[model samples]
Target: MRTYRYKVQTSSYGLFLGITAEAIQLNAPPTSRNQVSDRVWLDTGRVHHAYSGRKLALNGQEVTWLHLGLREYTESIELGAPGSYVLIIIHALEVVDADYAEAALAPALAKWTEAEFGLAPRSGRINRDSTTGELTFSWDERPQ
Candidate 1:
């Protein structure tokens, strides 16, 4: 198993997203619309901040963010028989309670992972560290 880890830190908090796979592949096609299209779910915590619209585009292998007031969002494209991907988004806030944010986002993240990539958690765990103010999520590939 290979583990891929990525971390992004802001002044207020940090975000971590990872994925483990038997093999990882990247496909960079010439056409703009080479990516697999899927709907992403967002949990804005507050009703007012809910994601109103989604516009997904592929710049090489990266998926752009949906309009949800997020400072930054990203994803990786995996190429294979059961191709899949992972996404990470961070909000720019002056002061955020990491614990609360993690608790609120975990289930939403899980649901998004399953829906977007068609993969379920095979091992490991997802969590957010209050002290470090980092939200962490991970998933493994399904068995053949």
Candidate 2:
């Protein structure tokens, strides 16, 4: 098992984390629209979650469609606004899915943004279209 870690810093002040993996088959369907917020609904691998330190472990071969649902707080760093953020670190082992893991994990982060904030915002430096008045929110920001 290779030491693998993925880190993400989000400006969402109060966040709830939930995870899903392809390896574990769900015996029953999710009880609610946002099971991620309901920590009790989450079980390891099946409906994986971390209430305290936010860490998950699973066999590499069993996972393919791993996704995370990050429940967002009311406050958000608007398109061009500045704010503080929280950093989330995910640790995993590389045994059989090293190649696929990289591609699959990248999109999960973006999905988190959509799940937390609506489609109007995206991850990256802030950019706006002057004529259209469109806003491109920043996914990562450096505090000075």
Candidate 3:
């Protein structure tokens, strides 16, 4: 299984959701349009503040894929700055076979969103060691 990761700050909450939805659309499995739902489940906890309750799941593929398919996790890091400015790492994982999965959503999201710390939101593709399952990530230099 491959993991797609993005880095963002508290201020980019809306940007995060936008890019995520766009990424899912970019990588949606091939199927009749009517089979997929347009609705995304978001909770109030992740909507305004606290960062503890915020989670977004795009289970729109249940009809087509027969499963939730895509799952996301957001890690919040407090910087102790005024206004509680914090960094967030968002990760998306596809549970289905790659052939019918939205594996490209992260990369597409990275392309559509702004960069941070001079690095794309999707800093790199995460590789899991087949034996140990240890993950590794790296970002390639693209022409600016």
Candidate 4:
């Protein structure tokens, strides 16, 4: 297996972290006034699973968030404004094999990562594994 890493710097103080699946699902439904959004019914069990049964921390500190769950088939995270750097980790297994895994998903993930953290694409670092099928991306403050 291979591993890939990317670094990003966000202007926003807080970071939004979730699986690509959740991001896609969250944006899949059409916007309408009369209908309840699909995001309201999204299942976020995976997000809980990722954080549970392990000591998960960002920048050497435990991650604190206000909300974590699926609403309308989308997993969401709401951490108060705190940090600027965020690391994005993506595994090949997380996506379907037929989808070409990281190769196909990296671009979208990068775009979402930038938007979620309020960072420009040029401000982030992206790394991908050729053989192991792993992708790592991170965002941090840029030098002036």
Candidate 5:
């Protein structure tokens, strides 16, 4: 269970997440359409400003892989019986209460239990650990 922490700040319109080359796995299965972005879900809040959201593709960013938006996020993934792979954890934004930092969308997360490069959202909220930051959606590996 790896944890990728993303920081969200309020933009002039809505909110934006800063993604870098290290934010996602650079080396994953190649796609015919590398430009296509895969979707991941944000359980904390609903997003009201997707139109303003664009890939903040920064210069000199090591984007060997890019993630497109999907309808959701997944919990576990089966990358070919434990073949070496990186889970492309993307940091995107959706609309939610500003006070809460985490939402456990376990149902959505479970979709990836054995998926090969699948995108799904956490189905529900599991825990809210605000020890570090108070405005973040995060997850760890499923307990053994």
Candidate 6:
């Protein structure tokens, strides 16, 4: 198996999460209004979270506002696990194309890593998928 890593660029602070999963499974954001989108405010104290669209999901289940795919890939990517790891499971409805992905997903990942995870952000590369224009968000993080 091959491993790929990318840096994340975030507007938030501190944390960086690298998505090095086996593959990225980008899917369309869910429709129904049963859940809500989260609007967050990171600060000196506890961060504030607001929701109004779809709740975040890790693999295929609902998560708090943390919203990460690779984290849910297993229970522990904590310090010493095996395989690559994915970082986020974001809303991609507005991501009409790759350029949109650049603007939307890229920054989202960075900011998520910074504020939510509290890690410095950087760029990351995905293991190429078989199809083109296919949307997916999943990864593997093997210790090196």
The C-alpha lDDT values of all candidates are: 0.31, 0.32, 0.29, 0.30, 0.28, 0.29
Off by over 4 Å in 1: 1-30, 33-125, 140-144
Which prediction has more favorable lDDT, 2 or 4? Answer: 2
Residue by residue across 7-65, what tens digits does model 4's lDDT show? 23334221223333322223333333112122232222232223343322222111111
lDDT for 74 in candidate 3 is 17
Q: Write the per-residue lDDT of candidate 2 for residues 1-144, one digit (tens) a residue.
A: 012233333452112223322211233434432233322122233222333443446444222223232323212412222232222223332223222233334334445444433444443433345677342333453243
Candidate 5 segments whose C-alpha is farther than 4 A from its true place: 1-51, 54-82, 98-100, 103-144
Model 3, residue 80: displacement in angstroms? 29
Clashes of each: 0, 2, 1, 26, 28, 37
Q: State the lDDT of candidate 1 residue by residue for 1-144, as single tens digits.
A: 233333445566554533222222323221322132332222222112113323322222122221211111223223222343322232221112342333223333343344344454334244556798454544444357
Model 5 C-alpha lDDT per residue in residues 32-104, reported as the tens digit of each score: 2233223221121112222356442322212221121222222233322244333343334232334222222
TM-score of each model, in listed order: 0.25, 0.24, 0.23, 0.24, 0.26, 0.25
Shift of residue 100 alpha carbon in model 5, Å: 4.8
Strongest candidate by lDDT: 2
lDDT of 1: 0.31
Q: Model 3: per-residue lDDT, tens digit, 1-144?
A: 122333333331211222222212222323323221232222111211113334445444322221112111111111112223222223333232322223234443343333321232434453445677343333555436
lDDT winner, 5 or 6? 6
Off by over 4 Å in 6: 1-66, 69-98, 101-107, 115-117, 120-124, 127-131, 142-144
